[model samples]
Target: MSKSNFIKVIVAGFLITSIVGCGTKNFKKTPLDNYIVENSNEKQFSVILEDMDVDGTFFKTYSHKYRVIKHKEDDTPYEQISDWIEVDKKFFAKHEDNLGMVILEKKGQGKISKVASPPGYGYVGDSRYGEWRTHNGSTFWGFYGRYMFMNQMFGMINRPIYRNDYDTYRGGGYYGSRNYYGPKKGGSSRYGTNSQQTRKEKPNFFRRRASKSGWSSSRSRSGSRSRSTGFGK
Candidate 1:
């Protein structure tokens, strides 16, 4: 082959090899790593776990799903951000050194009042304790936040908390109803009907009627007669 032709062949081979190598690297990633790389550019806020005073095992199981959310109206600070976090016990112990840092970050958007706590991120007086807000895109939810009771390992623990002027100032419209924050009395429900009861008591008569109508006409006739007779007619 001519010198120029040989050089061109070599260049073509290099290009093909580079493309194949890149594709191979991407295909070899774990499912989780592939997801992170694919969606890393999503718009969302960041949350840093400053200090954690929990045991190494606890820290390992601690899921990091926190966010820095701004109030809707006045742009003040609400309790929790929004995100999903899951950390098991062994996972926590295994990654103790990686604690006190941003662990799990989620994406999405929407103005939710509270960030939902994972299995073990709740506390007594926590207004934004149990439930979480919904949003589009993706957002982060740190594993540890203010509600946890670790010593001073991390140095800071700023979980969600309602301000004194929360009730007064209505700047941000991102506030959940009174029922949203928490129950009236401390840990228990103060009102006559709690959300759980309301949901349970709330029946779908429409669905029930449809189900009953599905019975054979003969069965339906018997049911009507039985109801009318009070016993067996």
Candidate 2:
């Protein structure tokens, strides 16, 4: 072959090799990239347990789902700037940590309010307690109760409070209206009527046992129901 032809061939081969290498590099995926693709529709926020002062405690590391109320673009990929509310107003946070650069902000827009303890049931001073079902169909009591206690102890009253009148469903066969103290009076409570319809139409994520991480399980109260004449009929 002529010298000129040999030089052209070498240059052509190098260009092809470079093009293939760039394509392969662009197609490579990282763990974070895979996670974001898998959970594209999900809006997850992570917080360092140590920063919350509950790192070494039983509530060290946990994951809870929250409905994104509002957010804005920043240096990080996505930051929950405005306050966000949990289902039933059970928990709330003013802001969330940067979920790294892989996550994208959810499409829906809304506002979240802080949860408040039911009236007359002070976290630091009162003895009365209650339980409520979260949006994920998991029953959360002590975890959030402890969170409230810790916040109050440190004078972080701006955190959130639980509302006694907030609508929630009870597990098992029985369903009814739950007040600050317990089930409300009168046979036909709003919750009971609503729950009966909900149970038939909606299926929930129920766990048979507590998680190994020390999170309480709803199964503990699986048999705590007492038959009532009002809602069942």
Candidate that would win on TM-score = 1
Candidate 2: where is the Cα deviation over 4 Å?
Answer: 1-10, 19-28, 40-104, 108-233
Candidate 2 yields a Cα-based lDDT of 0.27
TM-score of every prediction relative to native: 0.22, 0.19
Off by over 4 Å in 1: 1-20, 23-44, 49-64, 68-75, 79-95, 98-233
How displaced is residue 173 in candidate 1, in Å?
39
lDDT of 1 at 38: 47
